[model samples]
Target: MSQAWLRQPERGSVGLLRFAAWLAHHAGRNATRLLLYPITVYYILTSPAGRGASRDYLARVLAEPPGWRQIFRHFFCFAQTILDRVLLLAGRTDGFELAVFDRDGLLERARRGQGCLLLGAHLGSFDMLRLLAVEQAGLKLKILMRPDHNQMITSLLAALNPAVAATLQPIAGPADMLRLRELLAAGYVVGLLADRATPEDRLVTVDFLGGQAALPATPIQLASRLGVPVFTCVGLYLGGRRYEAHFDLLAEQIVIPRSAAMDATRLWVERYAAQLARYLKLAPYNWFNFYLFWQA
Candidate 1:
């Protein structure tokens, strides 16, 4: 979880990813993406922890009939295929064809000389958002990421994409808080992935996907402290290298009511969780949470 780990080089994993990327690029879009379905299914079914979670969740989702669960699982796989095609095309086309939601409103709000929080999830390519921010919005976006265990993979992914590396600012400890505050003061948009809550982090419990789950309270707390607006941005993959970059103004204005920081944080987190649920329902497979989201 140290910042130094994120700087290491990938030894061989990059090669495999590059090959996969090439296949996704050269082969017929639908065909190549479809071929990946079995691979994903095989991994999900073969992995002990993953299979158990998938089975349990599938059962819960289709409690009415046993056959219904299998049918939906197959449909989910089909949807994943289409989503992969859209993602492949988005990368190949360099984001020109990506459909963006609330393009003007997001920018206008950002340009209003106030700090804003850009909250995203683990659903799709967040790096794509970095591209849009730098290329389209003319802004240097900074992301706060939880340090990954696989240092090599983290470094390689960052090094492979210069646009993403240039704007990504890795945060390790409380020491970086001042720097983050300064960035906000300077009107730089700060991006945070809010779906996962680790034991080491402060979290707020909320109902997500029809169950109770703990979500990171950092983003809302930071926004409240800075007295700024908070927005939720989602990149929905449409087929053929097109993405619908949707943005919702979660909190048009974050006000720290006198000594009520905790209450304000809870309110915003509830609103965010509700919106996230709606989007996940619209595109279930788009949710990339491999682990069980709701833990008691």
Candidate 2:
């Protein structure tokens, strides 16, 4: 919930993304994947903030302090996810191994048209989860997103699939809130990224990666108001062509009485932070918040 990510400039341009998309489609994935090496190297060399963030995160997650090789791999893993996002969005999931670990039956509920709040962190390939929940499991999923955060990437991804773009409910004004309520009422799962807190958001600090980091309280707060089921989800990239989507129920219904609202919110946020940390260690390179994450 440090706003450092908001302060950082968008790294790649639309034209560059378009070219990458073009290459991905025309040349096969194996051929196009070769480009990620240079792209990863370019970012590692050019973006000092991103490099430092990688080092800091890896140092906490790994047994030993991270070196150039670990940093390069971290950036490369992120680049790989970005590349796969293009393919996944374009409906080109031919060779990739897509696995889902939904032991809690949340996905089955989604498949049955039961509405819930899917709260996730920026830990892995969200596009993969979207593919599994929407395309595969047939869940009516509406993602709450700020399109203006990374306009170029958003625009490019939208261009790939207009249908997916239509599912994006922009996080603006009261009208969007009304839209979310309507969707939930009609049995649609609302997807939200809960880790990053904007300036307007209320936050709760928790122990994360051996340090105290603030996370947004608003997602859980909104769930409490809406009185819906809430689940924590993530799609982990397990190297090579394998990706796994996990879904775990966080709450049957989030209820915070006014008298204990702060404590209630903190409890839920801490639970989410603990789950996120567990997932972070499972695939450390997949933590893609490319900024000083432990700072304000």
Candidate 3:
């Protein structure tokens, strides 16, 4: 993949994140949460891009443009999730209440020594599920992330706990692709976020949140190539300290015969998009793609 992803700047500063981390650890989670009201207001007042994105997304799903309060709540929720990442990564999960709904027994019945791909989105904290796999089951889960997609937040999160950040993998050229294949063969679950497209990635547009939107087709390619089931995982914040995670089996298998490969991939991408849209409806504020997602 091209390094265009590196050029896409993130919203926050590393210095501010580091300061938040210091406050969370030294002053405690509750003590530092007093900062979110101001932080949310700052973003609402200063960041038009993110605020517009939030309102645009909300309007599509809510069937009307969102009020300032609803938009403010969106930013505040995102802020809370980021703050909780510090605690979750630092092994302070006792303060959180997690409910995992694996209706298809995806997480519960995961093969102990086999590898599969976990398809997640930018909706909620994908890091939340990492704690479950890393601390509870000890599964060999490696996340596939762009090299510099979230440079500021990534660096500060890594500073808080280096172990979790160590699992991020890149799937750019042939060499990295070979490594990912080898990891799967070696019984490692490779997790990838399939919600957005990188510049080098081919876009697959489908109906999402009552509008047509483009999402990356990489996960379909990987699941078919590796001959593994793709499981859909969502971590939703219900408010305060409660978060619900659902790990449902999305595709049993994806077989793209050479004669009809393009058609097959589009069909599969549409299926994934429909499922993602349903999850978005369930948790409106949890949609965290703070950008013009439906736009180019």
Candidate 4:
């Protein structure tokens, strides 16, 4: 179900993002936002895969078949966040108000100078989480992701603010892994989107939203190896330039003994998936992995 998402094409080009950014800066948020309507509708009609995926997810979450209006809202939410990403990366949140909930774990970790793995899903705007957490909490946050995952989007954001690309530690090679080790040992918080897996990644099936799906086991594996605490984070878009960030400690420390490595990994992956499910419920439309997740 997910290999295709890994192989899916990037929806927008760098030129599009540059134009959107220019519009936001010159025309302003309200006027620039007017473009999202036609853009969202274009995707709904052209990208049948995305449209069908949205409908399927809504069907399960709403407990019935969803209509065109609901599907359009889902697409609109996704488009809005994407448009805002340009501004968020440019360190502009003037129009947005963020409310963080239950961030004690992150604050405590920072106070102790203990590094952590902040595990987040495709839900909501992770750009907001990284922005506000560092701004308000004063945490040195670094992101670990597949560098080539979305070269188009990555390039666009980097063009908007080059430092955004500099902070990302790509997991495409072992050197990046070694760097991640160093960052954690040096007591810097590292964030990862743990829900999707690349072709080279490992997976473990877990129950999510009433069905089983393959979640990337790499995050748990690294935590077990690094001996760092894991915290589940979500940056839920509350619409209209408002967001609510939620952080809950998932594992104070993931200790997987060698003998029971298999069992231990399964336990934590399942735990993460369950926690992700809970966060999805808080902002159903915020879920942004526009791919079928449940295993057939």
Highest lDDT: which candidate? Answer: 2
Candidate 2 global lDDT: 0.84
Tens-digit lDDT track for model 4 on 40-116? 78878987888888887887677557999989999888878877877888777786888889888788887798989
For residue 132, give model 3's deviation from the true position in Å. Answer: 2.6
Candidate 1: clashing pairs of residues:
89-241, 90-241, 101-245
lDDT tens digits by residue: candidate 1, 260-287: 7667777788888787766655554455
After TM-score superposition, the amount by which residue 43's alpha carbon in candidate 1 deviates from its true location, in angstroms, is: 1.1
TM-score of candidate 1 against the unseen true structure: 0.77
* Best-to-worst ranking by TM-score: 2, 4, 3, 1
- Candidate 1 — number of clashing residue pairs? 3
TM-score of each: 0.77, 0.94, 0.91, 0.94
Cα error, residue 130 of model 1, in Å, equals: 3.3
The residue pairs that clash in candidate 2, if any, are none
Model 2 lDDT per residue over 39-115, tens place = 77888898898899999999989998899999999988888887888888898988899788873477667666678
Better of 3 and 4 by lDDT: 4
CA RMSD per model (angstroms) = 5.3, 1.8, 2.7, 1.7
| Candidate 1 vs 2: which has more TM-score | 2
Q: What lDDT does each candidate get?
A: 0.60, 0.84, 0.76, 0.81
Candidate 1 C-alpha error for residue 126, in Å:
2.3
Decoy 2 TM-score against native: 0.94
lDDT of 3 by residue, 9-49 (tens): 56453444666778888988898899878977887898777
By lDDT: ranked, best first: 2, 4, 3, 1
Task: Summing lDDT over every window of 10 consecutive residues in candidate 3, give the lowest-scoring window.
Answer: 1-10
Runs in model 2 lying further than 4 Å from the true structure: 12-16
